[model samples]
Target: MKKGGTAGTGATGRRGLLKRAAFGGVVAATGALAAPQVSRAQTVTWRFQSTWPARDIFHEYAADYVKRVNEMGGGRLRLELLPAGAVVPAFQLIDAVHAGTLDGGHGVSAYWFGRNKAFSLFGTAPPWFRDANNYLGWFHYGGGEALYNELITDILKLNVVGFQNGPMPTQPLGWFKNPIERVEQLRGLKFRTVGLATDLFNELGAAVVALPGGEIVPALERGVIDGAEFNNPSSDRALGFPDVAKVYMLQSFHQHTETFEILFNKPKFEALPAELKAILKYASESNSADMSWKLQDRYPKDLLEMTQRQGVRALTTPRPILEAQLQAWDRVVARLEGDTSSPAAGPFFKKVCDSQRDWCRRTGVFFLRNEAPSVLAFNHFFARG
Candidate 1:
């Protein structure tokens, strides 16, 4: 029910701007990679390894992105996408890219939070940064992007090419074997989750495990984990989570929009002719838009099909479970704020929450009532166009 896409593109009504303004002239001005004619003669090929599994929507996005780039470049920029473990482990994409072993890589920006907790603030957090629009606004228009580039690129010195990959658009809470009745239900539960969810889950006395998508189903099926949360209905169902765990709870507060990032080695990016630089960015913007659109269309249908056709148990997280999670989230976030050791993620989270709360107070409550009509109208508009 929420929106997703490239920053400044999709449901936001900025497609025209992206096409005509964002990089229209930047590419031509960068004389090095010049017209597609010259680059096409040489056929510059690059390797792009991704952290996502082949079936993941985000992975689909990456594949589509490579195809589009190849087409648009007219045979100049050919990219070979290697799945996780092709070159480096799934979780080590940023490191691989930073090391310049590959031309570029696709991964979630916050997964590198271990390098600097501040990266977590850019991704997602519980009881905060709920809306996709708010997150985009903060990153692109607010000081968030400047702060991020400053820290990650300027300070940490990693070769970074960043773009927002997903909104996972209001994900399901998780699949629970038993209904969560209260805050205590979370206690001692081993959950496969990540980011701020891990901290929040910890506060509720749950142990959090960070597992790749491929591993989640096996872990849950084999009883290595009590419960788990993945992407939207489409992705989870595709991966067979519904078959393994029938009780699918909705509205996970932990990851409102799990942003996927594409990073390349800085030196590699810099070494490219300015024209290739512009081309890559333009290609990224287009691919990102396409990726988000697929989710916008598929998620709703998948959720409906899962319940109606597959007999999967799909329902919202109980109010009590959500309420309890909120309490624990607040406490944990507050404690994080008070801790000076590394409050980067915490304070940035507070700002994002403040912004979202203020926006919701002004417009979101009323907006929700009109969403059905809006979705219908918006869908028709895009379909016809």
Candidate 2:
């Protein structure tokens, strides 16, 4: 009986040991399955800079883009935002990103037009489109993207990839100390602007000063410039333009439509995991749509404040001045497209210009036809009587 009891006790001990071993194997299997997830949780961080001041709405747009990218990345990718002059000046962002000093940057393509005239074709073209939306459609649906890549990568050979963000509204003619009652008034008026507009204004006989946004107010205060156009009403107000200049011209053909260029280092962008790269590109589209909506809401309010509270006089730019600008644009376009000064200039500029022109011809006709009734209805409904 004692021997049988000892044998039973040994049998029970063996069964318990086998059960614990089986549980251990299950735990090991679970841990093996979880190991890859732990590895994927590792984070990747990048530094970004913008050609906008810290308090500018453009900076807000940049920050909004960063926030969206981070949330979508699920903690795997992080982008840090720095305002203008953080690492380099506003116009040098493209070169800085190309050299890898910044992982990415936010600016307009026209800022680097000196590199190639084709940059203006993408940045801020003369008033070819009806509005910013029309230009954006050409960029996305038209062949603009391929030509843009050709200009940036193949021709210029910059090691960077760019996405177009925010489609800006028509920039004002500018703020002037005295009202411009005639096209001739523009002659010899020292003006501050950038991009192709500088050339256009110069053709119109203004002494164009290519000053950055931050310097415009100071230049105006110091009598260095007689008039200037920076961006929107809010930005112009914040930059203190209202204090120095009382006449705000409400329309212009100079930069009827433009968009922000968000650039990434080609190597860094290529090295990113496929999903992360998609996030970077798609975020621009999302942010651009959001920005347009915000602008629609904000610009009107700011314009009201500028006129009513700031003791500023707002006037529709005279018809002759508008007509004169269109004529100036004709000359500028002809010069850019006909110049064989740079081997890449004429053909590359024509490629982009042709694409935009073709799109404008077809799409613009449709817009003009469809928009006429809307304008009529709007006028009838909002008649000032």
Candidate 3:
């Protein structure tokens, strides 16, 4: 009876051992699964560069975007912001991002006009009959976003994803040794501009030089460029434009509805989990709204400072010159629309232009009919006695 009991106990012990080993195997399997989850929890950092120098207000705008992304990224993603020329020259930012040398960047689409003239259509040229904000309605509600994607993914074949924000007002004609009052003064003049505005000025017979923002003031001082325009009053003041030239040409058709572009390397951008991607997109949009509001405050204040303290002569571009600019645009459009033998706008440009015109033509009727005339209102409230 005792021997039989010992054999029974041995069998029970074997069963117990087997159960323990099986439990250990399940524990090991769970730990293996958990390892990947832990790996995913690690933070990802992106190297982002801006095409504006650190001192420029545009760079502050870039920083505003970075700050929003960092705060909203939920510790899983971080952006390390660098100013222009940190990773590559401002003009070469798209190329650097495309090659994966830089993870992302902030710049204007017009900066890449060397690659395709159609790029200018995204932001910088062919001023539609509305303000920059009104035109951005076309970019978002109309087919502009899709065409912009096609330009990047299909036509230009750049490995990038971009969003355009920061609707700038009508750019100034520029600063010259003397005020540019007549269309005739543009003849044989040396001027600086970018994007299709270069062509616009060229048709007016000015020798147009394309320089980045940081270089514009220096070029003007060195006579490398005779007269130049670099965005707005704040940026121009920061670039030391008032020190070099006193005449600040207030408004023009050139770059009348420009915006800033924020770019990401497509593969890198896609690899981000959907949450982080959403953060980036929403961050761009939020920054855009803030920029439009902030500029209203900053631009007016800076213009005041320049005019009141800095001996700057802020003059409206003459009516005749404005009319001439419109006529020049008509000719420029004809050439780009029909010119297939060269790298002018051609078919793809037509697609973009036609889309813009379609949106503008439909919306412009309502705008022209109902839009308030601000000049009369301003004169009533604020004009000097």
Candidate 4:
């Protein structure tokens, strides 16, 4: 009986050991199955710098972009945001991104007109489109994107790729110490602007000083410039333009519409997984739409505040000055199209210009015929006596 009990006990111990081993094997298999997923979860991090001060709405836009990308990436990708001067000066963003000193950058293409005249076509050129929507349509669908890539990658050979965002509204004519009632007043009035508008202003006989927004107020206070236009009312107000000089011309053709450039190093961007690349590109478009909406909502209130609270004298720019700007743009475009000094100047610029002109011709007609007269509407609803 004792021998039989020992045999049964030994058999039971062996059965328990087998069960334990089988359970261990199952756990091991499960871990093996999950290993690839764990490895795939490794995160990719990128550093992005913006050509905007910490307080500017441009920086806020940049942050929003990073936020969307991060949430969409779901821990697989992360982007770090830095303000202007974080990596380099605001204007050096293109070069820094190209050099891989920055993983990415946000700025306006017009800031780099010194590199290639064609860049102005992507930025704040003269009044070619009726509004930001029309301009962005031309950019996305009207062959502007291809030409932009050719200029950045093929023509200039910069090791970067870019997208357009921040569909800006028509910029103000800017702040002046004295009211500009005639086109003649622009002559020799040390002015501040950027992009092709600089050339246009210079053509109109203004000694144009191409300074960034941060420097404009100081320049104005020191009497270094007689007039300046940075962007919208809020940004200009934030920069203290109202304190220094108060004759705010409420309209202009110099930069009727503009967009921001979002740049990434070519090699770095290519190294990203396909999904991540799409996220970066598509997020820019999303941000562009969001920015336009925000501007429309916020700018009107700010303009009113500047007038009602800050006691700013906002006046409509004279029609003669607008006509003069159009003439100056014609001359500037003619000179750019005719010059062959730079390889990318003549044909490439003309190609972009021709595309925009065709789009403008078609779309402008529709806008004029189909849209209600906005000036009359404004006069009816909001015009002050």
The prediction achieving the highest TM-score against the true structure is 2
- Model 2 quality (TM-score): 0.92
Residues 249-362 of candidate 3 have per-residue lDDT tens digits of 988998888999999999999998898899999999999999999999999999999999999999999999998998999999889988787664788888888989988888
Write the number of the candidate with greater lDDT, choosing between 3 and 4: 3
Off by over 4 Å in 3: 1-41
Please give each candidate's TM-score: 0.79, 0.92, 0.89, 0.90
Q: How far is candidate 1 from the true structure (C-alpha RMSD, Å)?
A: 16.8
lDDT of 4 at 53: 83
lDDT: which candidate is best? Answer: 3
Candidate ranking under TM-score, highest first, comes to 2, 4, 3, 1
Cα lDDT of model 2 by residue, 256-305, tens digit: 99899999999999999999999999999999999999988888998899
Q: What global local distance difference test value does model 1 have?
A: 0.72
Q: Candidate 4 deviates by what RMSD?
A: 3.5
Say what the RMSD of model 2 is.
3.0
Could you tell me which 10 consecutive residues in candidate 2 have the lowest summed lDDT?
342-351
Candidate 2, which segments miss by more than 4 Å at Cα?
1-41
What residue runs in model 4 are displaced by over 4 Å at the alpha carbon?
1-41, 377-385
lDDT of 2 at 37: 81
Candidate 3 residue 245 C-alpha distance from true site, Å: 0.9
Q: Give the TM-score of candidate 3.
A: 0.89
